[model samples]
Structure formats: structure tokens, C-alpha cells
Target: MTTDHLLYLCFWCFRSIFSVITFSFTSSVFAQQFDQQYLIWKQQQNAHDLRLESTLTHQSAEAVISKKLEPKQALATTGLSTASERVNINQANVQQLQKLKGVGEKKALAIIEYRQQYGSFKHIEQLKQVKGIGESIFLKNQTQLAL
Candidate 1:
């Protein structure tokens, strides 16, 4: 072959190789993005399934509770009691404390601990001294408190 033809052939070969490399790199990047998107979609689907499962479990528990108790008794015993029922802090037990708004098991236990550590509650305001019982919580249950 002539020198000119040889140069042209080499140039074409280099261009072809460069094009192949660029195309391969672009394809790899796109494949990575697709993989990431598929993973995210799968994770979201799993979360949705978990939420549905939780709803079903809660419904099952509620069905059992409804069968067990009269509606009024069920409400109170389930810690969904009305705020109308008065609870004397001095006289109330762990179960009674749990019935109050925002008073979960931990808070109920804290109240019992405080009552046991200190003497009986002299004033309704003393409830504010308990851990987790801030001003708002104390105020909310103030109406339902007695000596």
C-alpha cells in the first residue's frame, strides 16, 4: 500500500476503537443508574408491603378486643378512657396513671417511682415535678386530678 493509504487506514482503526470505548462507557453508566433506580423501587415496594402488614395486625388485635369487652368498659380498660373520670394522684395506682392522657407505660412507671420516693402528692401541681410531665401535660390532666 502507498504511505497515504496506510495513514488513512490507521486513522480509521483508531476512530473505530475510540467510538467503541465511548459507547461501552456510556452503556455502563446507564446500566448503573438503572440498577440504582430498580433498587430504590424495590425498597419502596417493601416498605409499602410492611405498612399493609402492620395495618392487618392492628385490625386483628382490635377484632379480638371488641369481642372481649363491652364498648364502654373496653374503652377505659384499653387506655382510651374519657377525661371526665377523676384520678386522685395520691390514691391512684399504676393502672390509673396509665389511663391519663400522654401517660404511657414509662410515664406511669415514673409516676409510681416518684410517689414511692417522695411522700404522697399534697397538691395537683406536684405532678409537674415528675420526669416527662412538663407544664402542658400537667395542665391537660389538671381538670381530672383531685387531692
Candidate 2:
């Protein structure tokens, strides 16, 4: 072939290779930019979800705390003896009797059952008849007891 024709063919081949390399490089750069944008969006979504979850958890905790602090209205509305008064042997429940000093759940239930089967205690001395009570316990709580 002629020298001029050979040079022309070489120039066309070089131009075609350069064009392919440039196109590939540009596409890769665009793909990388798109991946970075997608990552940023996903991070923002995760942060938003975490914030919503935290708010819900705080609200539930506040609801539980408020319920615990609320007073029991049944005892208040009955217009019976106040909470500070000595527990009535005739009418006191196990829960109420358990508030006394040194009284546990079993002792409180025993006191209630004794009152139910027999009758109201006429005096503090009668409390000794219960299984758990003795002279020392009666003496210690005598001032706090009533008919």
C-alpha cells in the first residue's frame, strides 16, 4: 500500500480506540456518582426510622409511669376509713393488712382468714390468737391497732 494511505488508516484506528476509552470512563464516573447519592439517601432513611422508634419508646414509658402514679379510686370513693387508720379486723383485706410493720403476705392473709371465720377482734390482745402474732409483736404494734 502507499505510505499516505497507511497513515490515514492508522489515524482512523487510533481515533476509534480513543472514543471507546473515553465513553467507558465517562459512564463509570456517572455510575459512581449515582451510587454515592443512593448511599446518602439510605442513611437518611435509617436515621428517620430510628428517630421515630425512639419517640414511640419514650411515649410508651411515659404512659407506664403515669399509670403507676395514678391513685386507686375505689378505696377513696367508698368513704370508709382513711389509709392511715389502723386496719379494721372486720373489713381489712390482705393487701391492706400487709402494710403494717413486720407483716408479710402470708401473715396478712392469715389475719384476714381468722377474721372471716371468727369475728372482729374486740381488742389488740385478740391479735395474738393469729398464728404469726405473739406477745412481742402485739406489744410493738399495740399503739397502732384498733377495734
Candidate 3:
């Protein structure tokens, strides 16, 4: 072949090889970028899942603590008495004294009013000042009642 033709062939082959190398390098770089992005996304998702799990655990712990606290609060408020136990007219408030078997709202209010005017009861007999309570009711509840 002519020298000019041979030179032209060599030039074309060199151009093709350069183009292939450039394309391979570009493809490798793009693939590496995609892999890095995928890894970052996976890490973010894992972190989000961990946060959600921790929040749920905290909520459950709060619920359990609330459940445990409720009975203690009830015991404190009710003075360790069951519903059947007679309430102390002297020490009890209007709301607490009203929970007694025979006591109603009016009686409860009357007891508070009498206590406020006359001060603390010295004996169970002082409860007779309340409207509904008489000798018989006081006698009946005397064993269960307190000062």
C-alpha cells in the first residue's frame, strides 16, 4: 500500500482504541458513583429504622410505668381502705367521706361544714352533728370508723 494510505489506517485504529478506553473509564466512574449513592441510602434507611424502634421501646416503657404508678396513687388517695370499709369522718374530705355505704353527697358536705365550724372530732360521737347520722348509724359503724 501507499505510505499515505498506511498512515491513514494507523491513525483510524489509534482513534478507535482511544475512544474505547475513554468510554470504559467513564462507565467505571459512573458505576462507582451509583454504588456510593446506594450505600448512603441504605445507611439512612437503617438509621431511620433504629430510631423508630427506639421510640416504640420508650413508649412501651412509659406505659408500663404509668400502669405501675396507678395503683400506688389509688392506694394513697383511698387511705388503704376497700369499698366496704367505713371512712373516718374526722380525717376524710368531702369526696372521700362520700364513698361510705350510708353517706350521700349532702351528708358528706354537712360533715365538712360541721368540721370546718367546730374543728376536729374528739370522739366518734361528734359525727352525729351531720344530718343523716344518728345514734344507731354511729353505733353500727363505730367499729369500722376511726378518730
Candidate 4:
């Protein structure tokens, strides 16, 4: 090769090698910084999570205490009737059926229509056979249901 070409080639090789070494050094420094920052973030996250758990536990305990203090009032507000006041699904009207948990107007009407079409319900469990009434609805209203 010509002298000028040889000089240019050597300069390019030196610049490339210098760039690689600089990049590697910077990468290691950046990786260390990133790892340290990540550890600090994890520690802060753990502390915040602990604080949230404490707050949630305190709130739940207060809720349980309040419910225990006024169980009958809570039951009345939740539309759960006592055993003596249980709704007879075979005889209850749409409004009476609606008083059961998870039973809206549609569900109540569905129950009445089912009862009329099938005659009196032989057992409380038969309520699950109606359309829109599944296991969850039947279980929720089981205590309030009768023949």
C-alpha cells in the first residue's frame, strides 16, 4: 500500500480500539450504578408494602369490630331476614323474592315464572334450576328460602 493509505489505516484501527475500550469501561460503571439503584428501589418498595399491609390489617380489624357491635342492624341492612321471617319461594311474590340477596327484579320475575311453570318447588335447592339462578344465587339465598 501507499504510505498515505498505510497511515490512514493505522489511525482508523487506533480510533476503533480506543472506542471499544471506552465503551466497555462505561458499560461496567453504568451497570454498577443500575444495580445499586435497583437495590435501593427494592428496599423502598418493601417498606411501602409493609406500610400498606399494616394499614389494611388495621382497617379490616375495625370493620370486624364494627360488624360485631351491630350484627342485627347489619343483617337488617343487608336484607337477610331471620328464620321466622324467611321467604317461602313457592308462595313469595316478586317483591318478596327480590328481598333475597343477588335477586333483582329480573331474577325475582324469573323465579315466579319458574314456579308457575313447574308448580310448587319441591325443595329449596330446586331454585338453581331456574334461568339466571346459578349455584351462587341459590347459596346466597338458601337461608332465606323455604318450600
* Backbone collisions counted per model: 0, 0, 0, 0
**Alpha-carbon error at 42 in model 4, in Å?**
28
Query: lDDT of each model, Cα atoms only?
Result: 0.83, 0.74, 0.76, 0.83
Model 4 lDDT tens row, 37-141 = 999999999999999877765655565577774554444454445655688899998878888888899999999999889899998988999999999988877
Q: How would the candidate models be sorted by TM-score, starting from the highest?
A: 1, 4, 3, 2
User: 86 in model 2: Cα distance from truth in Å?
Assistant: 47
**Residue-level lDDT tens digits of model 1 in 39-141:** 9999999999999877765655675576775555545554555656788888788888877788888988898889999989989999999999999989888
TM-score, per-candidate, Cα-based: 0.48, 0.44, 0.44, 0.46
Worst 10 residues of 3 by lDDT: 71-80
For all the candidates, what are their Cα RMSDs to the real structure?
A: 9.0, 20.5, 23.2, 10.4
Clashes of 1: 0
- Candidate 3 lDDT over 1-147, as tens digits, reads 999999999999999999999999999999999999999999999999999877765655565576665543444443444534666777888777766556777878888888889999888888887778888767766776777
Name the candidate that leads on TM-score.
Answer: 1
